[model samples]
Every structure is written in structure tokens, then in C-alpha cells.
Target: MERLTLSVTIDRPIGYDHHGTIYPINYGYVAGVIGGDGEAQDVYVLTEDDKPLESFTGELIAVVHRGDDVETKWVVTDFDVSYTADEIMATVRFMEQYFKSTIEMVD
Candidate 1:
């Protein structure tokens, strides 16, 4: 099995809102191939205040076997917070950077 791990650190604080409450948050996403096949699976971890809150596993968000590349984009939002696109993009970029740094292997 081929495994990849990516992580990023952000100077800005990160937080999440759930059930009318806001809390510090940390998150990580990982994707990789198995048995040298083209298909891939992904896992997403969401942590609040340094504790695990939720985890989701599913098929890869985007896959390109021929090109030997895969990409995943997650849009996390809190309707109550009303963040703009720029704000969202900033968060996404943070994740992107984190993933780029943390990835251990890709195939």
C-alpha cells in the first residue's frame, strides 16, 4: 500500500462553530492509493480544542491516474459565521500548504 501524509501549521488561529458554540479547531486530510491501482481513498479528521471531534472516510475527491496526481478540496462553512469567499480561500490555502508539507508518499 502507498501512503501519504501531509500537514501544515498556521500562525493564525483556527476555530470551528458547532451548535451555537465556537471552539478552537484543527483538521487534517489524507488521500492515497492502494495496491498500485488507480483508485484512491481519503480520510478527513476534524479536531476541536486538540481533541478528535469527527472523522470521515470516502472515495477520493478527484483522481487522475494517468497524470499521477490527485486533488481534493473541502469547503467547510458555518452559516452562522457568515465568512466570505476570501476568508474561505484563506483557510483552504492554509490546508493546501499543510498537506503539501506533510505528505509522506504518493503513487
Candidate 2:
């Protein structure tokens, strides 16, 4: 799969409260990359560390396409590991459940 090195700035950390929806994982964005929403590209960093993080440098493994929204979230991992689409979905469901999303593994 195609992988890109990205330096993500974690804006929303684990347990972050957003309108009563607690974040279960690290949610960040690539510093200079603008996404479909015209902002920093949002990313979901999948890592072994469960605690909150300030920033992460990792590989972009997949892209989450939201049919209902213009923003597409990317999945990144710091460890030398790969995650199936199902696994990625399950990990991000905490927030993705609100959108019609599909994961495209990088190739």
C-alpha cells in the first residue's frame, strides 16, 4: 500500500469532549495539507498508545470517504502495522457513525 509520511497535529485527543461525544482515539490533521473542507487535512492516528497525544509522525494507510460530507479523513499509524478496513472502521466508528463513510486502503 502507498504510504506518506505526515506530521499530524492532534487537535482532538482521546477522551476529548465534543458536544457530549467523547473521542475514543487520537484525531488530528496534517499541518500544511488542506482537505476537502479547505482546512488542514483531518487524520485518525491509529497507534498502540491509548493516551492523548500532541502530535504524531506516521504513515498514511487509508482514506475515509464520507459520502454525505466533503471532508475525507485519513488513517495513519506509527507502528509497523497494517489495519484492515473493518478494523479501521471499528476504530473510528465513535465519530464516523454520524457519516456515510467507506475506507480506501492506499495502494
Candidate 3:
């Protein structure tokens, strides 16, 4: 499978919630990678761990293409981890629910 490696700065560590919506995992961005929004590309790190993280390097498994926003959400996981498009959607629904999106599976 083709994979993209991304180094993320974990801003929202596990156990963090914004606006009453709890974060189920780590969420951050590639420090210098720019997205369609003209800023650092944002990322969602999928994991079962509740421990916080300051940074992470993982495989890009999927892309959450938002039809309403200029930016797309990239789904990243452990080097040996795997998650289906459905799983990715389910994990990120808390905030993704606010956007109109389609999951694009990456291999």
C-alpha cells in the first residue's frame, strides 16, 4: 500500500474537549505542510490510548474531503495500525459532524 508519512504537533492531546465535545484521540498538524487553506495542514491521530501526546509520526490512511471548507482533514495512525473509512468517520464525527465531508480511503 502507498502511504504518506506525517510528523504532527499534537495540539489537542487526549482528554481535551472543545465546546463540550470531547476529543477521543490526538489531533494536530504537520508543522510546515500547507493545505488548501494556505496554512499548516491539520491532522487527526486515531488511537485507543487516552494518554496525551506532544508529537507523533504516523501513516496517512485516509482523507476526509470537506465539501464546505477549503481544508481537508487527513487521517493518520500508527505505522502498523489500520482503520477503515467508516472507522475514521466514526472517530472524528465530533467535529467533522460540523462539516459536509466524504471519506476517501487511502492505501
Candidate 4:
């Protein structure tokens, strides 16, 4: 398990999935980290709270690698939420299902 401590800011809140599907978690990106997509690394902030945030400093617990997509997403948590690879996949399946993905667990 590779546990990474990093900081991120949330741009997406719990709401519709742009396609009208409800998002159960917050999603955003690390401020300065760049990813394969040439942007700040994308991240999923797994929390049940409805509050939206501009920024959050937290930990990167895993990386979601998509076989069909050009981008990899970092899974981060601002609070005390944790999940196994399987559990994480299930939670983000709403959108991730469109792409073949594997979760690389971190400490």
C-alpha cells in the first residue's frame, strides 16, 4: 500500500453526472500536479457530505488506471474515509464503468 499525502481542491460536488446521473462523491484535482492529460491530476474525493468545497488538502490513497482512457485519476480523501480497491471501484462505477479501470492501492 502506497499512501500519499497531497492537497486538492474540489470543483465538483455531489450532484448530477453531467449526464444527469447523481454523483455520490466529490471530485476534483490536485493544484499543481500534472497528469497524462496535461492537467492537474484528476481526483475523486470520496465523502457523503453535500457541502461543496473550493479546495481541500488530504491524502492520495490510490490511483485509478483506465485501460480505455488516456487519463489516470487519483483517489483522495480530505476526511477519514478509506476503501479497498474493490470497494473504490464500486463507488466510482457510475462513470468509471465506461472505461476499463484498475485501482492501484496505496498506503
Candidate 5:
């Protein structure tokens, strides 16, 4: 089945801190045509330091068949103290690719 992949650039780090430890947060917004069929699915995956925290998989965040039109937004606190837009985008891209690859492997 063919999958649709979309990419976006983020300029800020999305993370949060608890107690005295800081966590690196990562997230992805995915929407695509399902196997060229008329059905579509939107999904969101949020993580803390490469671990899955929460996810909306196999369905759209808002609607099931409206996956292709789904949108995702994420916020992270306490990223690196010196991160820049370029660095954040690079990190987001890496996480997005990793998530996509992992999902494909599991399918």
C-alpha cells in the first residue's frame, strides 16, 4: 500500500521538565491517503526522549475518514538552552522519519 508523508519545520523546542530533570520532547503530525483508497487517517505521536508518551494511531484526531485533512500541534518545554530553528527542524525531521520508518516496519 502506498502511504502519504508530510513534513513541516519547527523553530522551537517542545519539551517539559519535572522535578529536577528535563526531557526532550518530540512529536509528529501524519495524514495521508490509505493505500490509494478513498479512506484517510490522521495520526499524532508524541514522545519524551524517544519514548512514546501518547499517540493517536489508526484514526484521525478529530475524525476517522478525515485523516487526510487532520492537523497536529505540539508543545514541549525545557529543550536545550541553546537550540535554534535549524537545530529544532533537524530534530523534528529526524523524529518524524524515525516514527514513519518504525510504523512501516510494524505494518
Candidate 6:
């Protein structure tokens, strides 16, 4: 898959709580991009910075496809780093664990 640059607006920053779960990473959406769920594309921003951000601009690394849902979460990063499927899943498992999902690399 070809990689694309994305500008994400972080609605759920690090430590953000959704019900009882705290977010460990920045979670957001691309303004003009729409997903299968008919909403702005959701994204999980992974970075080594370990700080909350209002927005991020990065390359699309992989996509988290949920078998039972209409939305597919995108994974993006600013660093020149690679992640295995297992590692990606482990990092996003905080919320992804509730869905039947799989990761597909952009490369």
C-alpha cells in the first residue's frame, strides 16, 4: 500500500479516559477524510514523545481493520520506525481488545 501523510486532530489525548479506560496514546481524526463509518477517519498517533498533543502530522503506517465494525482506525507516526503487527496490536489493545481487528501495514 502507498503511504499517505495525514494531519490528525487529537480529541483523545494521552491519559484521556473513555468511561473507565485511560488512553495511552493520542487518538484523533482526520478532518476531511471520511471512513466506512461515515465519519472523519479515526487515527491512533504513535510517537516516542509520550506527551499529549492537539494535532499531529505523520505518515500512515498501518490500518486497524475491524471485522465487526464499520470504522477502521489508522496508525501513523512521525519517526522513521517500523512496527510488527503484534507490536502495533499490543500498543493499541487498550481499546482494540474489544473489537475483532487486524493490522495491515502500508508497506
Best-matching candidate per lDDT: 6
Tens digit per residue, CA lDDT, model 6, 52-85: 9999999999999999999999999985778888
lDDT of 5 at 4: 22
TM-score of 6: 0.96
For model 6, state the Cα shift of residue 13 in Å.
Answer: 0.2
CA deviation > 4 Å runs, candidate 2: none
Per-prediction tally of clashes: 8, 0, 0, 4, 5, 0
Residue 106 in candidate 4, Cα distance off native in Å: 0.8
Segments in model 3 whose C-alpha atoms lie over 4 Å from true places: none
Give lDDT tens digits, candidate 1, residues 2-81: 22233322222245654543434444333343223343322233222355334433222222122233544333222222
Model 6 is weakest, by summed lDDT over 10 consecutive residues, at 78-87
Superposition TM-score, candidate 4 onto the true structure: 0.85
lDDT of 3 by residue, 32-91 (tens): 889899988899998667788999988898888999999998888888888888888889
Ten-residue stretch with the least lDDT total in model 3: 1-10
CA-lDDT, candidates in order? 0.33, 0.93, 0.87, 0.81, 0.31, 0.94
**Roughly what TM-score does model 2 have, to 2 decimal places?**
0.96
For model 5, what is the alpha-carbon lDDT of residue 69?
Answer: 30
Kindly report which residue pairs in candidate 5 clash with one another. Answer: 14-76, 15-76, 15-77, 16-77, 42-67
Candidate 5's C-alpha runs over 4 A off are 1-69, 79-82, 95-107
Clashes of 2: 0
lDDT of 4: 0.81
Error of 1 at 73 (Å): 1.4
Q: Rank the candidates by lDDT, best first.
A: 6, 2, 3, 4, 1, 5
Worst 10 residues of 1 by lDDT: 58-67
TM-score of each: 0.29, 0.96, 0.91, 0.85, 0.24, 0.96
Candidate 4 runs further than 4 Å off: 48-50, 78-81
